[model samples]
Target chain A: MVREQEFLYASGRIRALETKLLSRTIVERILEAQDMDAVMRVLSETDYAPDFEELESIYDFEKALENSMKRTLGVIKESLKDQRVVRFFTLKYDYHNLKVVLKSRILGVEVPENLTTLGEVPVEELLKLSKGEKDVAVPKLMRLAFERAAEVYEETLDPQQVDLILDRALYEELNLLVQDIGHDFLKSYLAALVDLTNIKTMVRLKYMESDLRTLKKSLLPGGSIDLEFFEKMFQEPVPVLIEALAASNYSKVVKDGLENWVSSGSPAVYEKLVDDFLLGMLRKGLYKPFGLETVVGYLGARENELKILRVLMVGKINGISEDMIRERLRDVYA
Target chain B: MEVTLGQVLALLGAAMAVFLPGIGSAKGVGMVGEAAAGVVTEDPSKFSQTLILQALPGTQGIYGLLTGFVVMQRIGILGGNLLPLTTYQGLLVFAACLPIAIVGLLSAIAQARAAAAGVGIVAKRPEELAKGITYAAMVETYAVLALLASILMLFGLKLA
Candidate 1:
């Protein structure tokens, strides 16, 4: 199929789904729901209920919501059957599965069966791969990642390095795929990914006081930050770092965040600021002529909603008050 | 007969006008896609909100293209040549492409970063994504204005 035709079909399906996203009023009503069943009912009334019957409990309801979303997304992926978009989604799962497996193996922690299988690759296979027992193509495919991560492990044994390597490798692979496809939406999406990753890395390094070399090594090279500027920023004191960021495109947001961090002396504010900055960008970037944008955007929104739901659920289970939950809630954009 | 420097510059300007914004938008939107995928994997239901988030970075390319089309018309590349071929004319065309090209390049990428983070927001708080998108789009206004100014300049050149 022609790329344009695939995009048209995908966009059409996305439009249908987009129509069903909850409005402020609907979200408010859901928030006011007295119980899980009421919330489920609210969800069912909307377009999100296709797989609702599969739920067996409140937890099941959440799981089913996630699963249904995956199913729907899978359907959307089918629209791009001729393209590598499906592989893109599958790679995400692969990344997640690899992370879970590696973390479990390195920490000598037992892997939860449910947690293991949630991403692209099946949990069992991931477990085997983690144990160095699997000779499947995945290991070969991830050869670069394995080698890089091994080097990090040998050097510092910092599990974070493993994460950093995986993230960098996955992004590199994803970047190549996006470039090959050359769609406007996909390009923007990948760029955002790089930017966010950089922000996250910068924030973590800042908090940890890790040197520029370590931080630089951890970054995915193709991001917005140039190596020279990144090094300069890293060498500067925290105050200087904040000032440098404040002078750039991220100035206003980062400045405000820095002020808050200074006043509160809390790193959480910075983390939240990073979150806010990236979220704000994604919301505006997807409206133009790209079917992939819509699909990808919907996927993002769904994830945010789930995170909020999970927070709310945990609060409910713990008997936390709504007001407390409200206070604890990070700015949605943040 | 040889192509004058003036003619070469005009062509270069027009080409940049067309291609630069396209590059910017492509980069911007690609940035957001990564975040969107991550969000959807965690929760598929927030798709609509994430779509809006991802769309924020795409405007730079549109603005760039609009400017290019207008410049083409002004240069008589599309129709009539109202302006005489002067070094100044070439310079103006070159100048006109600069703001959109440079801003389009930088802001589009910046917005893409914002979109990636926006995806995270959607994943964690889908209902609040509109505000996030608005914030991301704010940066593109300057690029749009720059493109508009270039088009206006072309119109003025035609009148002159």
Candidate 2:
């Protein structure tokens, strides 16, 4: 395709860079590293980063990791021929910051420390918009979500509604952006992500034995499993609903998770498996070689790598067991 | 008016041999340059290695120029005189140029993609630059063969 040719160089560079991604063996070694010092030593071997030599504590390492993530995002944005794709990926962070701001405002406190500063909107502007100040500088979608979330929080005096409002608004805006982009592959990827997110919500609510109305309210529409379609599936029991997912790409994950959930009754494994399934969806982008897929896929890979490292490091700091830390690790990109 | 149709044909053959492959090589080299620039922007240490890969796609232009030069000399155009070529001989010359003209254009561009990809390999792993060059060189074989075929045909052309 002409699109493929357009991205030939960027994709080629990414392919080479991907070869240097942390291998599963290396990640395993890092996880098996006995102490934080040992872990940081193994991390120093990889590009886990260049400036983390001063990282003595988990907080220090997080800051370093956050900086690297910001740099990587900027690099990937610069490399890609399409900035729209990056903008679309950035929407999630804006929404995430929006949520943090709302929570901070609700608590009548300053915006929490280490709230991710990875979005298009600055923390200052997002906080302004979250406080229901009329700031035209804030993005329209972000402002809309913040105002709506704050209004609902005021009405119900429930923090839950704020999350529901923002999440729904996030997906609604993301799906619209995806449509505007008009790339079928991305559309499919985002659709699959939406489906996974909806499943995550359903599983969480189902395990909590929350009311069906709450579950219905939490459900994000516009996935392949539309809200209209899911309304029929909603009335079914959690196990049966999970069984329905067996027909989807998450068949193995849902089935295996369902088997485990029966004994544990906890959706933890199910949630992990589903998160992995989402990454698996992103993994298939490697086959495309040239497109928005490689750029977006590498971002996903980098994000997953960061997440695993954080999990491993935090688990170490908290004196958690190896198996517990390993259980939470996402699949490695390499 | 003094130039015969045969002379025009022979000149066209020379032009085709030079222009098509030159354009192909230019495009190929430019593409590789863009890729190499990106790598160099990230890591300046890879400049020498990427420069080598960037030069790979440029050989087709030389082959094209050589073919064009030989054709022009054969017709005495470069020598400042026009040969009185028959229509058949003109067609033969035109046919001879086709191998390099077509293949050189295509192979150069293909080689450019390979060379650019090689620059990527060099960017990430400088030690693997040779392997990347080998990949780019694979696309060079067809261009060489095409040049050989064109040269052989041109030399073997019987002027009547």
Candidate 3:
């Protein structure tokens, strides 16, 4: 009872912050805008207005988006009593930067793009760690995962192995983090994320006509659905997999995602459905009066909003048709 | 001036009436204040609106203090002549304080949660502040009833 009340301030702040989230209508308006300038105009009217004002150029949308993400996350971090909740949201970025740094080191190439500062570990520290410098303290889990992924890539000579190893390690760290936090809601959320990703991988590999060995290696552990279930479903056709999934919680997601995949010959719709499903799960925090749920849910919503903005901006820059961009658009939390 | 067992019990009753609900109200009001501060941090214009929600939980403490004040008066702690309460009468007074003391403690916390939720409403929909207050006020009804029961019991005691 006492601990739950600790979140009252964060819950109230998130509730207010929720009003600033872009609605589906606003996303559509951004989409309908004739040019990038019109998109900027649409965004300028929202909370992103302040972010845009500091931009060096109208095209520096990445800086604006990253600044906004960093600021929103900072707000959440400051308000949260349990910093582990922040780790739950941010651990991914650390793993992401690790992947970029380690892979570039392995390939002997210049780091391709900018490392996100959103990770719990700073980019500068991660870069130093990649250079085999031990001066900076990094999380033991990430350091071990990075070394292991590098070793696996060296042995297998497969870049895919790097991703699989790091991805598994990422989930492992998330699993440990949530366990330490000790919330059933967070544990279930982690399970769902793992389960959904495993399912997506299984479907994609099936389409690739990959061997069972490849599928076995790529599937992540700690999901509610065991490996045996994926192996069993892997042999059967897509329809049978759909039939099997109907009895599980992901029945609607699989059914809709698979049908779209079958019709469109693309996984874009499935990806979108997966995001929407996760957001829907996070939004369950809304029903809870006060707790970590609202805080985590708010973070998830902010991330989703950033993703939508990224897609819109990327599409506009590339001169993709609005309809094409709309096809790939995921649901907004607002 | 040795304190009699009866006087001790009567004093215990008055202390419980003041402190238990007072603790509850402090917790309740603090919770609402935290939530209200969150809203005000985002939009300072909502400060007055959220303050109203913060005040809702505070009534439980006041109700408790009122019950204590009446008990003090009845026992002559306020009137300057401590009543020579019988042990049975002291027990009765102690029993009377229970309704407000226990209820005030629990109801104030409950009302604070409702009022904190009202802060969320004020954050998003400032126009519906009344509805938020109404929900919080609903929790106040139980606290009010408990206060009334304690007051009535204190007044009905024939301590003369």
Candidate 4:
């Protein structure tokens, strides 16, 4: 049995670590850098220097930053002595790897050679799974997940459908485990994640004019909305769908996105709006009475920070002016 | 002389009164702490602001403890019993603990979540930290009110 006290102690260590997030001033400094070399000079003063030095191009720099993040995350996970929390994070990586593999197979794209491999199943195992000849050890370790995915794959008889099913199933299983921990902090974070993902998928489906069956298949099972209610709302026209969602916590920005999508016949802005809203929500929700949410919220903020950095760095390298980049930047809370 | 059951029940109510709010505050703090840690890992410079943001939901626990203390005082544990009470009278005091304890516990957790999200906002847009706090405090108001009512009831109760 995991000792709750140890978890709390580890959480204290995490608290100390949270004192290191980049400030707005730092972000601004990085934004003002004239080139990638200048950006690297600024980054060298911070903890993000490890992979920042390995890049030959803007694209390479972004990839390296992503790799560094994964590596740092791996190190942090190792430092955590609490097995359950470690397992929870590992499952997240596992899901992420699974998604990448499935996407590569379906799109017939080559798997990136430098893909981070921190999940228990390993990169080799994922590669084998992608080739449709699952290895015994990996599948055994992921038996329940593989079985569920296989069942969905068989029933749907469509690769895309199978992928969607697996995604939803993995999220449900992970969320159930989080709930069983009985930590109120984890519960709220998980709930918010589920809601965000469900809403994003709903909006995407609406944009695609997907059939009802496909839309239903895309929705995750354990969001704030009941399946029946979600299906009903999803069936409405796009404008009505926005109106229905406006009643929830995500109203302000999502409603704005819906209006934009209706007037312009483009969902791009709405997609960005959703991202901003979720990021904003996570940022605000994490700081109070600090615990697990703080850790997760910090991780999310770091991801956004990196995204912003990458955007700025690329814009600078491509000779895009600050004004253009600023105009294109989505509000963090929109 | 037999010690009345009313006194025993009142004692239990007082204990719950103190413990429940404590639980709520601990839970609330834990939620926000997790979020803060995650943000700090990526960018540690936002530490001061994040700490402030994460600490906001912890008031519920403090409020709960205060209510518990007030209840204890009213029952004469801290002073002389001013009135004689029947078993049903003690039950009313015990029942009063529920609204504050339950609401305090749940609302603190929820408010912490709102605060966690707010912290994320601050990390990205430091200018909007106040707005985020306002949103988080919106959830905290009900829990505070519940705690206040419980305290008021404990003081108003006339033990006879």
Candidate 5:
């Protein structure tokens, strides 16, 4: 608790940064922009405003967006006294990078160029570890994950198994880290993420008409909701899964998701609800002036923004309708 | 020259009045300084606004110093004119300094937290600096009351 108090300033500064985050209105303007020139004009109004000459492709703008998020995380990390809490949030990116590396290895292709520099492990080291190099150089938990994922992938010859193995491993790693710190907000946040991910997996698998066994295998462990619940819950259809979501802490959020799912027959609404729920929880953590919540919250918001920017930018470039692009955007941090 | 217990008690009271709240203010200001610097680091334009918020917790130290100065002068510690004191009279001054010593210490730290958060407000929303200042200033009420209680008691303590 005393250590949490040390972040009093850093958290406050984060709250300040939250206000500076591009608002829904700003995003709306970007969406409403007439053409690429108008999009550039809108970008000029934002923190993203820099040399327009450089952004020839939407991919460049996407890189710039990722860089901005990276910069923000770096600044927040620099300010924090104990960065371990923030480090846990960055672990998601590590897992993401892990997936990328593993997929690249499986496909016999080079690792994608858009690899984020956001995680604790360097890209070079992760890439090396993925190629079956030095066993001791990488973190033990990550090495364990890589080994598990590789074994599962080799045995099943299924890429999905690799994803599930790594996904479960990531949660286990996060659970260990969050529990060690014992920050109530972070613990709750991690639980929310797990539940949401679990729920999403259930929804997606059910939609694909997957068997209960496959569904159960996909569900990640280490969530606050008992593992027994998911074993039972995964047996039900997508609509029945809504009952579980309603029973859990996501009752309010699940209402809209379930309604949308019933009406549209799409999990898009449900997924968005979960995203908003997760983001809302993180944002609410900011009201308190101390602790790891703010640092983690900033990173979460940054990640969400990157996703939103990419979707909106790609949606615009692809000439996707405004309504479609708007539907695709997750809840904004600001 | 023999130093009496009565004079010693008076001196101890004065010393605490200076040190306790001073320490609190130092910590409070330091805490706010860290937050303010963080804000300024992100947005340099917010420096002035954050600077004002950073200064809020410092009042406790001033209040503490004021009480200590009064106690010192009354006891002739600072005036360079030593006043002979009985045990009971010294106890009165000691009891008088207690309000600021304890309350000032707690209040300053509490205020510092508010002030630090205020620095955040200025960082994110520079136009809302006044609201941030108001929030931080709200925490200063208890400190001010403690200072007042201390000063009034110090002034009321008439030593024969």
Candidate 6:
């Protein structure tokens, strides 16, 4: 109880900050803009004004967006009393950087300098860990995953193995962190993420015409949908798998993604569905007065808004149609 | 003047009536301050509005002190005479104080939660601050009822 009360100030600040987040109407206005310059104009009206104003070229919107995300995360990190929960939000970025570094090492390509700074671990440290220094400040879980992924890639000489191993490790470590905090909402959120990832992996592997062995290797642990159920899914058709999961919580997402894949031969709709579902789960935090929920919810919302802006900006720059951009836009948390 | 066991029990009751609810109000008001400060930090314009919400939980402490004052007066402590009483009468006075001491402590905490939540409303919808105040003010009813109960019981006690 005392611990929950400690979040009172942070949660309230997040509530005020929530008002400043990009709303659906603003996104619609951005989409309605006729050209890239017009989209920039719309974005300039937001908290991104400073970044947008400083953009030397319209194409450099990606850098501006990155700056916006970094600033948002930095503010959230400062307000939070418990760094562990906030770190959970950024842990994915660390794994993302880790994946890029490991893959580039295996391919003998130059490590990209544009690595994200959003991770809990610094990119410089991640780069050092990639050099097999072993003494860097990376979390033990990630360091071990890094070594394991390196060893596995050397044996198989396959790049995909690195992603699977690292992805699994990310979730496993997230599970452990949430367990340590002892928050049931976070535990179940992680479970839902695992379940959705497994479902997405299954659908993608099925589309690739991969064998059952690869499918078995890709499924993650700790989701409510166990390995036995996924193994059963491997034998059945996509629709049958959807029906099998009908009684579970993910039936709608599974059905939407699978049906879209079956009809359009693409997993795009499924990816959107998964994001919307997770946001829906986090939306429960909006009503909570104090606790981890409000902080996590605001963080999730900010990340989602950043994602929406990225899609909009990329679409505008690439000259993709407004309707196409709208189709790809995920639900906003506000 | 010599202090009796009955007077000691009654004094304990008066102290509880003041301190217990005072502690509760302190906690409640402090919690609301933290939350209200968060809103004010983002937009200083909402200070007066959030401050109203912060004060909502403060009534319980006043009710507690008022009850304690009434008890002191009835016992002649305020009159400088110091009424002598049987042990049973002191217990009766002790029992009267419980209504405000217990209820004031609980209601203040509960109201603080409501008021802290109201800070969120003010943060998001400044126009709806009234509704937030209304919700937190609903909790004040119980504290008022508890104060009335304690006051009525003290006045009804036939200590003489």
What share of the reference contacts is kept in model 1? 0.00
* Per-residue lDDT of candidate 1, residues A220-275 (tens digit): 75566576766676666557766777656677656766667667766555555555
What tens digits encode model 6's per-residue C-alpha lDDT throughout B1-160? Answer: 7788888888889989999899999999999998888778788999999999999889999999999999899999998988997788899999999999999999999999999999999999999999999999999999999999999999999987
Ranking by DockQ, best first?
6, 3, 5, 2, 4, 1
The residue-by-residue lDDT of candidate 5 on A113-147, one tens digit each, is 55777777888888888777875467888888888
Against the true structure, candidate 1 reaches a TM-score of 0.59
Alpha-carbon error at A242 in model 3, in Å?
0.5
Deviation from native of the Cα of residue B67 in model 2, angstroms: 2.3
lDDT of 1 by residue, B6-36 (tens): 6567668878876887888886676566456
Q: Which ten-residue region of model 3 chain A has the weakest summed lDDT?
A: A1-10
lDDT of 3 at A315: 90
Docking class of 6: high
- Residues A19-132, candidate 2, lDDT per residue (tens digit)? 667889888897788887787788788876574775665567788878778887887777766677788778888888888888888998874654786787788887667556
Which regions of candidate 1 deviate over 4 angstroms?
A: A34-38, A47-62, A86-90, A107-118, A147-156, A237-239, A265-280, A283-286, A319-334, B1-160
In CAPRI terms, model 1 is classed as incorrect
Please provide, for model 3 over A214-261, each residue's C-alpha lDDT reduced to its tens digit, 9 standing for 90 to 100: 999899888999999999899999999899889999999999999899
C-alpha DockQ of every model: 0.03, 0.27, 0.77, 0.05, 0.50, 0.85
lDDT of each structure?
0.65, 0.79, 0.88, 0.67, 0.79, 0.87
What are the clash counts of all predictions, listed in order? 56, 0, 0, 61, 0, 0
Cα shift from native, residue A136, model 1 (Å): 0.6
Highest lDDT, which number? Answer: 3
- State the fnat of model 3: 0.67
Which candidate do you rate higher for lDDT, 1 or 5?
5
Highest DockQ among the candidates is held by which one?
6
Please provide, for model 4 over A121-186, each residue's C-alpha lDDT reduced to its tens digit, 9 standing for 90 to 100. Answer: 677777776676744456443555655665666676567765675677678777767766666656
Task: Provide chain B TM-scores across all predictions.
Answer: 0.88, 0.96, 0.97, 0.90, 0.95, 0.98
